[model samples]
Target: MILFVSGCASTYSTRSVEPSGFLGDYSQMRAGAEEDVQLIYVNPQADFGRYRKIMMDPVSVYVTPDSYLRKVPKEQLSMLVNELDAAIKTQLTPHYEFVHEPQAGAMRLRIAITEAQGANVALDTVSTVVPVGLAISAARRAVFGTHSSIGKAGIEMEILDAETGQRLWAMVDERAGRKITGKFDKFSKWRTTHDASEYWADLVKERLESLQAEHAASTP
Candidate 1:
């Protein structure tokens, strides 16, 4: 079965940059379509799962759109961006053009997130009774078998014209809180995995790869 998934939002732990470095191949996502060429990067958001939800999880936080830098507690955002800048550069192709502003060139694209939180709740029976011997002495929080991810997050992207700012390609990446295991597909959500950093990285890699393939197919 064929599925359409879009990724836009990102919980960058680094400082924001101009996004100009990603110039090349930026047009392929909207190749053949007339107009100037520009690639815009959307700010990433963070979705949190509190309470019991945090107890069980896969990836803690998920970043959308992808960035060379991640915002952290105490660090220069630009510095962080530099660290991942190379990786991000290598990811984009050497053909497409990137523009910081929108114009008549290529169309525009937007990125967004959906349901970015989840949890695993193991509910127990809470009763109130004053029996002489052993009525309901006290309530105890027992660990039920095991509940996987019970929360979810999503993202979306849209491509528009550079000058007139017209709309073109659009995509939304979403995930339903589902239990995941091991590394390969490893992910972290909020407290479940401590900021879903690696998870977001993996998704970003996949997105870049997808863009590369599309660029090649559309290239003359």
Candidate 2:
């Protein structure tokens, strides 16, 4: 399973360009730059706060046909999907009602895991790298370039009007695994899949909350 650092939040910026006709029907608005940690596009006129219900589709693994994950056992993939779906539900439950199916006036959240790299935990432990220093170095490297050593995870999601199928928002983000530090040796460790899941889930929740607040304030 892939591992990722905890508290690794993605930074996002919004663009006001017209949606490119690239992603088929869902490309009403497209995000800028392929390398951004979080690329978000929002309909400038949409009132996000007005949507109180959401229908989340099952999380899908969209890796390449011949990707390394294809060789992984089926049970492992299922476990990852289950964890991702549960994490999303847990994060959104506090802010909106969940529906079993799409309905009028509701929003639909579609999510997919586009890429994942599993960590070699045994290798990480035996490797002579200093945990704290390596983590700090990794953070610095992230600002300059992509560094995928232990593992990584990538995700894409879209929010649309359930009835009209109008794209309201969309984002893509990815995070890399990092070494962990602590007061004692027991707690100082490498990142894990659970840590990655929590970080991404919390990032999504925070972004949604910010959008909701912005819309709420703008309403007359």
Candidate 3:
């Protein structure tokens, strides 16, 4: 069976930070004008910076029992995953060694595209067939509103200890349409899957650096 799911409403982005089984209140950290990057799970006692090598799995397409992920064209899905992998590797290479396979003490990074809304083919057709005024209206709505019928994407990631298979950290994030901003605020642009991957990779690097600093401070 195939089931299709559209992107969540833009207003819900802030409230969506509560991941399944997450204990932290991420909403407090969210800024009004930006998408929230929630750290859903973290092992407080784990020394994250101790790991020297990491094994990153190919990005997977996650789907529920009633979902239609399988219906998505294989070539399109593969392209998205490839872009995601490349973005992550590019950002993380400066921070840690990447291993081709899992090994003792190596950290494993698992990532999945858990939700997606593809470009609206029907709307595109309509825009071409209908009057120019209607097309302009549609474009304006896409840029300023939830983009409920347009392309959007979400991803989830987990960091685990390869040896013990223990989860060390996890996060889930989603994005849709361009960001709305005040005239005085910095202009915010729409983000694609590759952008999301880069954002998360940088976040991980920052977290590791903080952990290393904390460890150094405690050593003496």
Candidate 4:
């Protein structure tokens, strides 16, 4: 019975990436939506309609032994986190008021970048080692959603009640860049990470909207 239940549950750690222990716990996470790439969990008691503000914590990078991003230069890692923060803020700012201190109606958000891998290790290292980052082409961004070889990245995030410590929602997702090579082959190692951050931010906003809708529908 235990094995059967375990088989039915979604696995957070995968061959391409593993949980960096940044989330602290992964026991409640399960298959998210119909997508295999996402693992998520939401507290049943969470009422999204009650929150009108968000407290976004600084984005963090996992540097433990299991992290693929550990070897990345500090500057590159900082860039990744900053880009992710900007992406998320852009998505959420329109829907919720941004707050610094914990208040009555707010949710605190936290994110951790777990993996960032480029297609060629030598080239990847060189790109980061140098001061100037590689320039990514618009064509590469279009192809990034399809074939994957140029790069890949992963992230984990959680939302918690601002006043209380209870977790409201959490998610883990990963994405890979395309294999297409040509004039666009030489791209930034953080390109996929940037794309994934945008995707996650969009999803988080959509999920919050849906949660609010659900509460509204059930209220009346």
Winning candidate number (lDDT):
4
Clashes of 1: 58
Estimate every model's Cα lDDT from 0 to 1.
0.29, 0.61, 0.57, 0.69
Winner of 2 and 4 under TM-score: 4
Clash number by candidate, in order: 58, 0, 0, 1
**Candidate 4, pairs of clashing residues:** 147-178
- Angstrom error at residue 80, model 2: 0.7
Ranking by lDDT: 4, 2, 3, 1
Give a tens-digit lDDT track for model 3, residues 1-220: 1111122222123234324222123332222223445334667778765787889887788765533345667787787788778877886788778898778658998888765556454553354346773567456555754433334566777788877877776667665432221122112222334445555566666666666677777775
**Candidate 2 wrongly placed segments (more than 4 Å):** 1-6, 9-36, 128-148, 181-192
Native-to-model Cα distance after best TM-score fit, residue 56 in candidate 4, in Å = 0.9
- Which stretch of 10 consecutive residues in model 4 shows the poorest summed lDDT? 1-10
Clashing pairs in 3: none
Cand. 3 TM to true fold: 0.65
Please, what is the TM-score per model?
A: 0.34, 0.73, 0.65, 0.76
Candidates 3 and 4, the one with greater lDDT: 4
